[model samples]
Target: MRFTLFISAILLLGCTPKDTIAIERQLILSADFSHYDNFFPIQTLNLIKKGIKDKIHIMYVCFDPGIDGEKEFPGEDYMDDFSFKIMKDGKYQPTFDKSALVIGNDFKEYFKEDFDSYKKLKAEGNISRFIEMPEKPEWWQYDQTPKNSKGKPMTFICQIDMGRIIINDDCRLFVFYDQDDRMVKYVYQRT
Candidate 1:
């Protein structure tokens, strides 16, 4: 009976599920931002907002290691509940879309200011530009060891985008990664 169940499981694994096969062809910057509580550690997000020359799509992905409930993000309701804030002359101001809790106000302005530049570049056929990662904290790969299904030791790699930026207990910013950067992981949230 156990052997039969095992074989069935194997067959299921072999078949590609419909949900897994569909490709989400949207460009989004995936990051984890639930760990930050206030505004001090959010300098990176604040700075990013000040930079960026065009409108770009960002897909953020946040994983909370301590809490298990659904993550709270900024959107239409409160309008000011995010890991990062937009400040002008040391005061908060509303500018970009706060729906996804994404940082870098400059990124939003870039899109709005140069709508045709991006399209022009696309039309010119020179569209492959790599996004530069700023000097910030990231997840480390060497510290943690990978484990198999049976919990045995295996190889490990880490991709850290950003992490908890805490100016004080009340204010912070959290960032995470979508790809693995094998070396240099500091200020990375340890899972």
Candidate 2:
């Protein structure tokens, strides 16, 4: 009877619900482009450029502009989500249709002064030429390794697209490559 009770108690203890802790192992950078000189760093840009050169896939995450305050937009089933794209045969191909992911109005308003230039570039389709140029190291701030929510040290690479004036402050796109250098994750932060 004692042996059976002990075994039963052991089994019960083993079956007890385990405390689960969520740990974020991935590195994340919170970049505020408005103060580009302070947050954007040079080394990170170089790393990202290298990743792009290596043909790593890019993932873009953004909130649905039509949605408001955590409320789902009519006919929308999923929250603002990540969009993955890959370069195949020198062409960028998105995994899903991205007709809904338009630039936010706030960004357009904030960059109103540069709107005409941006429009011209868009019409010319020569935006890549500007981004492909070698970035001046002096233009960026220093690299910063900050602790994430999980207390893990992460490389935080932040950049502001001053030239493009494309995205709003609430919307952020993070670009990084995996160990294989075959995948680039572009995480968009929606306020």
Candidate 3:
């Protein structure tokens, strides 16, 4: 009975009305990035990748043009770019500009900063104002438009929309997500 309900809920999610903001609100608020981050930051992402096959999933009809392949950061290939989109027949669509997420050890500090900000936001009841990001990864953002640490132009559709992610002194990551939640892009520096 429980399994049946779960499947039904999943299916119902996709069927929500196009003009409805409730579904999206519920989806985003329900997400606990900390839970995933706790076990899968840069230093341990590889282990998590090897051990756990999947952590999250999203459904989109199509993603606009974006970067592709692995953008390596000198010492490792921790930062990965997965940019895609989903098409839903809705009059009021939203975008989730999440291209400023950093993963792994390099992003630990960034996440710490974001977590601190999140705490403040939560305490002030202003969490609705803006999403947080890892701290101090802005240096990477200055490299070039649609580019990474290697100075190579990134063609992918994702880029940091707001905030930066800094793990440790040497590692950094970026995030990009569409407001429509169509493209949930997450770039993390893997140690």
- lDDT by residue (1-191, candidate 1, tens digit) is 74555345324323211211111112111123223221111111112232321222211222222322233432321222222221222222222233333434445443333333433443554232211232332333323333333545422111223221111112111232111221111112233
Candidate 3: residue 55 lDDT (0-100): 20
Q: Assess each prediction's global lDDT (C-alpha) against the native.
A: 0.25, 0.32, 0.30
Ranking by TM-score: 2, 3, 1
RMSD of each: 18.9, 21.0, 16.5
lDDT of 1: 0.25
* Candidate that beats the other on TM-score, 1 or 2, i.e. the better one: 2
Which digits, one per residue and each the tens of the lDDT, describe model 2 over residues 1-191?
Answer: 74565345334323211211111112122121121111121111223323334322222233334534233322222333222233443223333333333446664444443444444554664342222121221223332222333545432232224334344334433443333323333334433
Q: Candidate 1 — number of clashing residue pairs?
A: 22
RMSD of 2: 21.0
Give the Cα error of residue 59 in candidate 2, in Å: 11
Model 1 regions lying over 4 Å from their true place:
1-112, 130-191
Per-residue CA lDDT of model 3 for 1-191, tens digit only, reads 74565345334322212212212223332233222332222110111222322122221111112322133222222234334332342122222322223345544565566555434544554222222222223435344223343544432221222232222223233443333343334453322
Model 3's alpha-carbon lDDT is: 0.30
